[model samples]
Target: MARRATVYQVAERAGVSIATVSYTFRQPQRVRPETRELVLQAARALGYVPSGNARGLAKGRSQVLGLYAFDMFLPCDLSAPEVGLDDLVAQELDRLGDVRRFPLYVDEIQRGFELEARRLGRSVMLGSGTSRDSLGSIDLAGSVDGLAIFPGGAARDLLEHVGRGVPVVIFSSPPMHDPLHHITVANESAVRELVDHLVEQHGHRSLAFLGELAAPDIGARFTGFQGALAAHGLPVPEEPFDSTVLTEDSLRTLRAAIASGDVPDALVCATDQLALTVVDLLARHGLRVPEDVAVTGFDGIIAGRLSDPTLTTVRQPFVSMGRLAVRILTDTARGLAHPTSYVLPTRLVIGRSCGCS
Candidate 1:
């Protein structure tokens, strides 16, 4: 293999110091236009590419930002249809296979992040983590100037550890006692509107929230659920159903609820995925949505839009949130003033599932 060209050779060919060549790439505004052009021409002639690692070492900051998500890019398993999948579920699977892609809420946010980062002349380093391993597995601390994390599956200790040295912006999670920056949606307000719509418009007296308490966003939504009930003088339920994503366990729980005749008037799921699954499971149990049991969900994912009855949900400003996260990270990295926390607005979308015509 031939030797790769270096900045030293470019600087020699341009009759300029290495610092001038560095500024030509890293900070062209600081270098004269004529000098910058000379350096560029020399670099082009030598076929030299500036080393990002070396530039970061010299500048004490990488020009790239890190975005860490939990299982955001995990490939969908389309090998075979699982047994007992309803027609709707199978149709969704077929659509995903036809497109050869399925994107989660995190992927939408990532698009916004990437667009804004590119506009600001920075790049993003995408990373993924899982519950079984810490975010340290990605090893992004020294590589990026700052990090934006969707701290759901990540450990709090690990987040704090990473934030100690890097400016960390936690998105889509509840507020933390630590001083780390946060960017979340208006979970309380959106849930209040959703629940209020159910009670005031649909005359739903008894309602149940389905979500896992372990997740911070779900906890926030649950708090909002209670607040809405109190505001309307409705009795607060004892606890939300302990559930995560849609799974066989969740289906079993729904079946049991139906069999025992303990179903609520309306079930407010913390996520669209759960609500969609609940709708399918309820249908399998001979229960009609809205007519028998009203259902609503948070996070206006695309799957919700394609549901049979369509999902009643809170549409979070994910694209705006992603752009804001990148702006915050870049501003903080540059020692500029930035809010420690930002809560964006959300809109309540009434669909057929929420008993809306």
Candidate 2:
């Protein structure tokens, strides 16, 4: 039998480091194009067969990146208020069509991760998440090398499972959950910008945040709002000024604020969907937007533009986030030093809702 060619043999023949050879095969971006091509040509010339089995044995899985939502429903419907973050993800996916070819699949929890297994070409698989409960779908992830999860209530369970060997990256707004890589937004800066826009540019002193206060984002945004109020010498209320941390409760809190005459001149929502809902709800109460209560939302989505008065918001760049997740997962699979955390910037988009140009 011919001697089995090691990665070292491939590296020597291709005139590249073992890392370059690995990068050439698994993550082409890390290796220079010319070097990657040379390595590939040398691999072919040596009649070297890259053994998926051997590779799996060496790394414990193929170069499959797993992405999961905590719930299967997040993929198909974003309007469901209980899972508003899913709406943010939906907007992000819309923009991610061109970055890389690694296909994405949403797990239904019915079949094994069949959709992902077939579409991925040494690719990344996004799962709903293991936050609320074990995705039982994890059984299908034996072929995945790493996972990017949007954590929920059952995050700890999922974290424990991924600890079984697979590297885990958490896509969230955070202070870095230990042992899990995080990709977050500049939540504080973005929220501050929005508050500044609402208070300074729009000249609205009375403001409200429509979101779940339990979510970490709530604290960051609240802090920003308070900071803006302080900067402008505006009063920061001592009570809950229309804050709801859970998605299911957001509309109710907003509706109650409207009824109680406690509605702010400008309401900044934690998400686009909430802002959209506020628009509809306010209109139902016979109030004219901007003329009555200017509103701002986070996460720029298609629906935001179609609203009666287009929403002004902090666009979280979801597509960019998805693409970044893929890049990180792919690099990690190739044994590269992926950045410990990635925090993307957000932009304040002006629109009629916030009475902006």
How well does candidate 1 score on lDDT at residue 286? 87
Total residue pair clashes for candidate 2: 24
Ten-residue segment with the worst summed lDDT in candidate 2? 99-108
Deviating ranges (above 4 Å) for candidate 1: 1-5, 8-47, 71-101, 135-138
lDDT of 1 by residue, 1-357 (tens): 778899899999999999999999999999999999999999999889998889899889889999887644423353345666588677776676332134568878989999999999998998876745674524886689889988776777888888888888888776668867898988988899999899999999988888877777888999999999999998887677545554445555556789998899999999887787789888988899989999998888887887879889999888888899899989988899887888888999989998899
RMSD of 2: 10.6
Q: lDDT of all predictions, in order shown?
A: 0.83, 0.67
Least accurate 10 contiguous residues by lDDT in model 1: 71-80
**Alpha-carbon TM-score of each model against the true structure:** 0.83, 0.68
